[model samples]
Target: IHRQAHLVEGFSEPFRRAVEREIRRLGVEIWAGCQVKAFGPEHVWLSDGTELIAQTRLWAGGFQVPSWLSTCGLPTGPTGALLVDKYLRVQGSEHILAVGDCADFVWGSRLLPKIGVYAVRQGPIAAQNLLRLIRGQPLIPYRPQATVFVCVTVGNRVAVAEKGRLVWRGYSATVLKNFFDWLYMRKLKPLRWQEFFY
Candidate 1:
C-alpha cells in the first residue's frame, strides 16, 4: 500500500506508470492513497474501510531521522533530516557534511529523494570533498544524474526496469538486474574509496 497518489511519486510519469502496470500484472494489488488502519487475528482493516482476509502481512513504515539532529543546532527540514547546501554541507555548520537519507539536499527545485542509489552516488563526492577540505582546496558540488536507471523485482524471477524513456519487463529484466547486482558486488575490483579517508 502507498500513501501517495502514484506508486512511485517524484519519478518520471512513464516510469511510474510502467512500474505500476508491471507489478499489477504480477498479481499484486496496488493500493494507492491508503494504509492499514488496524489488523486482527484473522483480518486486516485499511484506512479506506476495506477488510482483507488471510493473513501474512508486511508493513514498511517510513523513515525517522536521528533524534540527535533536532537538538544539534544544525538546521533541519520538516522531515528532520539535516538541511544541506548544494555541496552537501550542513546548514550553519562548517566542516560537517551529510548525505544519503540523513540529509535534505535540494536538487534543482525539490529535495533529492532519499534512496540507495543517491546515497551510493553521494559517497565518493562526500569523501572527495572531505579530502579537498583537508588539503585547503575547493570542494566540488555533487551533480545528480539526469536519467535514472531502476529495476524492481515484483515476484518469482520477474522484474521491471526503467531508464529514461526505455522500459523492460519479465525474466530478461531480472537477468539484467542480477547481472548489475553481481557487478556491483564483484570483489576483484574495489573502488578503493577508503583511501580518501586516509
Candidate 2:
C-alpha cells in the first residue's frame, strides 16, 4: 500500500477505493472511518468501541508544511501555506518570488493542491515575472489552470489517469505515466541525470 506524496483530497479517494477493493478481493475484513483512539498491548482501541489487533500498523495520513517554516518569518495562512500575490511574489518582498509548493496562490480563493504539474507550470511564469520586474517592465499575472492530469498507481503494474472528464487505465496509462515522470525528472534535474535515473 504505497500512496505517493502528491495524492491529496480528491486524489486520495481512488487510491483508498483501490486498496479497499484489493482487500475485499483477498477476503480481508476492512473498515472505513474507524479512528484509533489508543494503542494497547497488541491491538488498537477505536473511538467507536472497537478493537483491532495487528502486528503491523501502517500510517499514511499525509504530511503538512515543515515546522521550521514559521521560524523563517514568511506570512503564512491558517494552513501554514505561504501567501503570494498573482505575480507569484511574496507579499512584502518586491523582488522575492515564490513558486512550487511554497506559493499559496489559489484560484477564486480555493486552495490549490500541492501537485507537480502546478509547480511545473508556475516556475516559468514566476521566472518571467521576476525578470520583467528586474527590468522595470510590466509583470504578468499568474493564472492557474482549473484541471490537471493525475496518474495514480493502483498496485501491481497498472495505473490510471484522471483529468476533468477523462479517465484512462491499464498498461498504456502506466507507460504514459512513467514517461511523464521521467520527463519531469529529466527537466527538473537535467545535470543530475544519474541521480534522477537511479
Candidate 3:
C-alpha cells in the first residue's frame, strides 16, 4: 500500500499496526512515505531516488468529489464537495439537499470527512428533514456522535477494527467486519436477511 505512515489514519494506533502487520504477512510491500516520481515500462522511480521493479502498478492514493459539482453552480469546498448544513440540506437552498461523499457537511468548526460512516448516519436525517420540509414541520438538526467505528480488511483473513480507544484485530476482527458488511447489505435488501442467516 502506498500510504504515508499510518496505514489507516484516524484509527487507533494498534489498529493501524495490526493492518500493517497483516499486509506485510501477505508479502505485499508497503512503500510508506515514498512518492512515485516516475514510471517506466518495467520500473518505478521514487521520490528518494530509489527505483522499484514491478509488473503491475495500482494507484490507491485517495478520493475526490466529481469535478462537475463545481460546474453545477453549487457552493463547494476546496475539494469540490457541495456545502451542506447540519441537516444535510444545501446551504442557501431549502429544496436542494446533499448527502454521502458529495456533501461537505459543516459539523461544528470543521467539515466532516468523506467517509461511509458519516454518510450512513446522514442518510436517515436527510430523509426525515426532507419530509419535514414537505409537511411544513420543523427540520431536525443533526448531531454526530463523538466517536465512530472504522474497520480495515486485509485480504480475506485479517482485519482491524477501531472505535475510539478500543481496537480489535486478527480473524475475529475479520468476522466482525464481515458482520458489518452483512448488516449494510441487509439494510439495502431486507429480504436477503434469510440468505445472510443461512
Candidate topping TM-score: 1
Candidate 1 C-alpha lDDT tens digits along 1-198: 787788776666776787788788878888889978989988988899999894788777766688998898889986789998877889887699999988988877877767667888888899998998899899999988987778777777778888778987888887877776656655446654333211
Query: Candidate 3: which stretches are off by over 4 Å?
Result: 1-6, 12-14, 190-198
In model 1, what is the error at residue 125, expressed in angstroms?
Answer: 1.2
lDDT-better candidate, 1 vs 3: 1
How many pairs of residues in model 2 come into backbone collision? Answer: 0
> What's each prediction's TM-score?
0.82, 0.70, 0.80
lDDT of 2: 0.69
Top lDDT model = 1
TM-score of 3: 0.80
Each model's lDDT comes to 0.80, 0.69, 0.78
Worst 10 residues of 2 by lDDT: 1-10
- Local distance difference test, candidate 1: 0.80
Supply candidate 2's per-residue lDDT for 121: 88
The clash count for each model shown is 0, 0, 0
In the order shown, what is each candidate's alpha-carbon RMSD?
5.8, 4.9, 3.1
Clashing pairs in 1: none
Task: Give candidate 2 misplaced runs (Cα > 4 Å).
Answer: 1-36, 47-49, 71-73, 188-198
